[model samples]
Target: MDDQLAFRADDQPSSTSPPVWRVLAVDDDVDFQRATAFALSELDLLGGRIELLQAFSCREAALLLARERDIALVLLDVVMETEDAGLRLIKALREVIGNSETRVVLLTGEPGRAPAHEVMRDYDINDYWTKSELSAERLLTVLTAAVRGYAQLKTVASARRGLQMIVESSNALFCSKNTRELSSKILSEIAVLLNLQAEGIVCVRAEEGEGGVAKARIISASGRFRPSVDASLDSLDSPEVAAVLRRSLQGQQTLCLSDCTVLFFPRFQAGADYACYVATERVLDDTELELLKVFSASISRGLYNVALFSRLEEMAYQDDLLKIPNRNALIRMLDMTLKDESKAERVLVLIDIDNFSGANTAFGTGYGDFILGLVAKRLCDAFDGNVLIARVRDDLFAILGPQTQVRAADIVALFRRQTRPYELGQVHSLSSVTMNLGDFTGSAGVALQDALLTLKQAKRAGHDQHAVYDSRLLGAHAEAYRMLLALRDAVEAGHISVQLQPQIDLQTRRVTGVEALARWRKADGSMVPPLSFIPLAEATGYILPLGDLLMRLALQAAKELADAGYGDIRVAVNVSAPQLLQHDFIERFVAHLQAAGVRPQQVEVEITESVAMRTFDTVCEKLRALREMGVNVAIDDFGTGFSSLSYLRLLPADRLKIDRSFVLEIGQVSNEQMIAEAVIQIAARVGMQVIAEGVETRQQADWILEHGCREAQGYLFAKAMGCSDLLRWLADWPRDRA
Candidate 1:
């Protein structure tokens, strides 16, 4: 051992040198352990000293290896306590603990028990040698080679870790939507790269010469740096860290010091500089240096893009004046919150300042803006980190979080603040208007729309009120939207038609006129009730096309009737109040009828009493012009609406059709009947021809005929049918009294 030593036994490495390469010697032979320890006492390889560890058995060696993570090599006797104890430990090292970097060499006294060739092939050991063959010089040579291999594997493993981190960082860059995310990812990745805990700060500052502390913004932080993440530079809890980063940023280069390191990244835009400070041991070798350089370079491009994203995010998602999130940001938060099923009691509250527009009008826009800013601050203070608050509109705010934190009662109480005069005049309370409990799944924009619609309904009910979004309200709106689309398609595809129900002279039972009713049939051969789609079309302004289609069908029927020797029979087409109030309704009516070679006298403009009553003066003014043009006007479904004496006296109709409701009861029991008779009397005084509808039985027809309704149309005579069917029936009708 004395002759095999490379250096004197007293020449031990100092503590200031790089970390030692730990070698474990596992052998039950105590003499062999002492000899091996002495042989490599003064040796060093790859700028690291060799520190030998001893264990008398495989179990003891395994326990020592478990505690030390950076062990470089293991020299073991093939037969420790058992014949294959060392071999079993090797298998445990390679498979159980997964320690592939540490090199293992097997040395045994009995060469015949384990053949050298087979042992090396069957195990992952780097070298196999008999105890006698491993002299001090040969062991020295083997130790040097094993240490070299371990050093190479360690470098490769570190490089592999760095590469994996780069891949993960790339994904982080790809997934990061804003600067805060990018900054956070960079910190975590750096922590992993340095093999340290995540204790760092990533600060973004303007170019140092441009301005110093004023432009510094701590974007992301973890562990000890977290408290100062949002603090002003002058008031930072970690002022020493800020100082170091500031000095590094001023250098405009990466700062590698003995105590800490600061990585400088100059963003391509915004004239910004980024500095990352990690609290760990000092920098030493090029591998760590190269790893950090590669990281900084890869993330430098990310920094450029992230700066642009930060600016764009500030503009698109954040409100400029109020310095808070805007509606778009709120939408983003809502989408994230809704997707996370683990979060409980998610609530989105929308606050609308009651009569805000009036306040904006009463006070100036400047004062209104001041009030909005106050409201934003108030909401932020009320919820803090518990909820996400946003200025969703000029006078509205939205809060999203757990229901317990984002409570309507709390919001209302916040708004119950005093509305009194201040230095900037007066401001109104931003009352809680509506809330959406996001217990359902959907897009964020749709959720907000439903909330707004609910707020609209609540406003119609009263003011300073808080309401939850009723799914039925959205359902009704969606139904109307679908109905309008279907109605438009039906009109464009010519699926709408006018079915004429024959109106006869009550005395002669002779067909005098036909009431043209609009009908819609779907591609599936199912009939859509007029009661369902008609009101939707009228309310949604889809009535113009639908009404025009019905008018064309009616005129075509009139022309076909005239050609078939039924010229005296008028086709009464029903027109809704919306269609009648069109700017060119009268002109379009005359032109449409005349274009089909059907005279205005051959068509009657029929409207329901409800339509006429709703737009009484407008309907009277428009229909009087049509009546003067020889287009006879008739009031259908009379007495079912506001048929007061004054409105009846002023109604300018050519005919009055009593509703089927009044006529149905006439045959049932007429002991107390005045509605039909009174309608008849009013029509006679107004000089309007009277017709009764829905007459199925002869008794209803006789009762209506006795009550001065000479013209009638019902299923009793003929049901409403297609024009061809009506034409065939008209040709075979009885011209004389039944």
Candidate 2:
């Protein structure tokens, strides 16, 4: 006992060292318990200290074990107030309380009183030692091995729990839809995964900077740093935390400190950049550091998914070209605003630039984009604070403002405001622009559709006016849409019929050729006016199909005319600009001619001057191809479009068909006759023939012939009629002239 006391005194370590072992001893014998305690104190495993706990009874032992879950080893007496009491307590610890990692060693005064080997196995006790035979050396050896085993098992259990926490955090954080919640969860999970007890902060580097001291914004903070959430990293009161946060962000890697650990989660592919700083007194070993690395990787993946989802949501709700809220976002705004009954007087105004495509033709696409941007800015200015402004189309802008700010007079004043001229390529200046605006009184359902309808009506009314929406406009728009659908059906069903008006030779009074006119005949035997449906066809791109059908019919009729002894006559068909600009248009037209077996000479292609002006290069190429095929090209309604005669020299036309407006009141007005003469002179100078249209009176015919226009077509000669009537009229032309 003296030697053992000396050994323990010599082996005792300093008080500053960590407690490495917690052992429990249970026995009713006071002398044996004292001896066991003294023996444990005598031995030291390096600088590791042992903490001893005593329990005189089985009940006391079970309570102590239950209270101290991390106890490393338990020494039990087989005969403690009852036989096999130690075994029963061990069973409670193993099966009932489920403390499987703690090792148990049994000591008995009587070996026969102890349970058999199978009973010991069932109890899951680690060792069996008779008290009489047990030595100090043997006790030290058992405690050493049992404590070592316990330490290893605790380490493994901690690592497993850490992995489980990481998996749970991944599930929780990945469910967050945006950056805010993702960041908050990251900060909290860092503490939980690492078993941290101190403060931490999560930050993101928001902008690129030149210096290594890049600015980082804190997204979330916990513990003492909770108030620092959403603050700048530079504003943190603790210099150590700020330094570690900057180091993590700039180095783009993990950093370890004495009292804290900083981890960098770089932007995943193109995701949001982030970092986390955890301050704790607990030291991180190799196992914890490795687990943290794995945990951070999972966090980065979840953040990347959240960022990608947010970006997709933004794209879905925002306009790409205008960089403003688009139709979808506008719908959302309307939904929220309309549901709030407090703000009921909201108004929406839709503005459209008049002839924007013409401006694009005048300038380039870049200038068109510039103009749209300018209009967007102007709309924003006009609406001022809290109002929503967006570019809805290439040439359209939408403004949502209070009704007081966007009244009819206010819209008028907005357009009439004096604006500085815009320079084009440092040369040309545009002083002012015109727009049509449509206004609706409420932010209620489908207001944008109503605004668009009113805008179309305003444009049809003329430029530089405001149209207020009403129920009548919706009915009108629906009727117009129905008419368009019916016209399309008409073209498909061959209900579109052609009437031919004869072009007469004024001097010889003989039919020179005929012009084909398209008319829509409804299913109900009612006729739709060409004025009402033709423009609708042009606007809706139905003109292409309608034009193709008309061309085919006219060519077939021309072939019949040639077969019926009218070979000298030529059939003129009007072609739209869209039809001419279509791909493979010339090839398709030639195929139609050949299928009808009509010579190109007997078919004339007529296009309005607007087609030449709008699509100059394409129209010229098509006209040259027509001439190459021996089809004479004529400009129909020439004087009405493109007042500039410079296009005449560049155009490949055989004749200029004077617009009906000039010849409508010919000779009744001196300027009208003089204008007709001037057009004829211009055509003659270009080696092109002159034809006068709408010659409704003999005076108009005589006036055109006096002005050197030899060809004329109007009611004075004959009105447009069906093929049968035209054939009959041609057959009796000599008698009709008499």
List where candidate 1 sits over 4 angstroms from the true fold: 1-315, 320-324, 349-385, 394-397, 405-443, 446-495, 507-510, 521-526, 536-542, 613-618, 639-651, 665-678, 681-687, 705-708, 735-738
lDDT of 1 by residue, 1-738 (tens): 111111224767777758688999999988889888888888766576788889999998888877787888999888878878988999988888789889998987654345443465467777777776686656765786677667756765765565446446675664565667878888888888888887655565543434343356677788876877665555667677778887876666667778788877654422266777777666547887778777776666676655544565566677766989887689898888778874457788888887766665668567768778777877888886868889875677888888767788777776453654354433344446445454556667767766876786677666777787777876776566667667777877989887999998988777889988889999999999999988766654556767888888889999999999999999998898767877678889878977899988898988887878875788789978988888888888888776576787787778888888887887566546657887788888887789888888888778778878898888788889998998888777874333
Q: For model 2, state the Cα shift of residue 315 in Å.
A: 7.1
What does candidate 2's lDDT look like per residue over 405-484, in tens digits? 76545544554433543544221211111112223334433565556655665666566656666666567656767787
Model 2 has an lDDT value of 0.73
Which 10-residue window of candidate 1 scores lowest in summed lDDT? 1-10
Off by over 4 Å in 2: 1-331, 348-385, 388-477, 671-673, 735-738
RMSD in Å for all candidates: 30.4, 32.6
Clashing pairs in 1: none
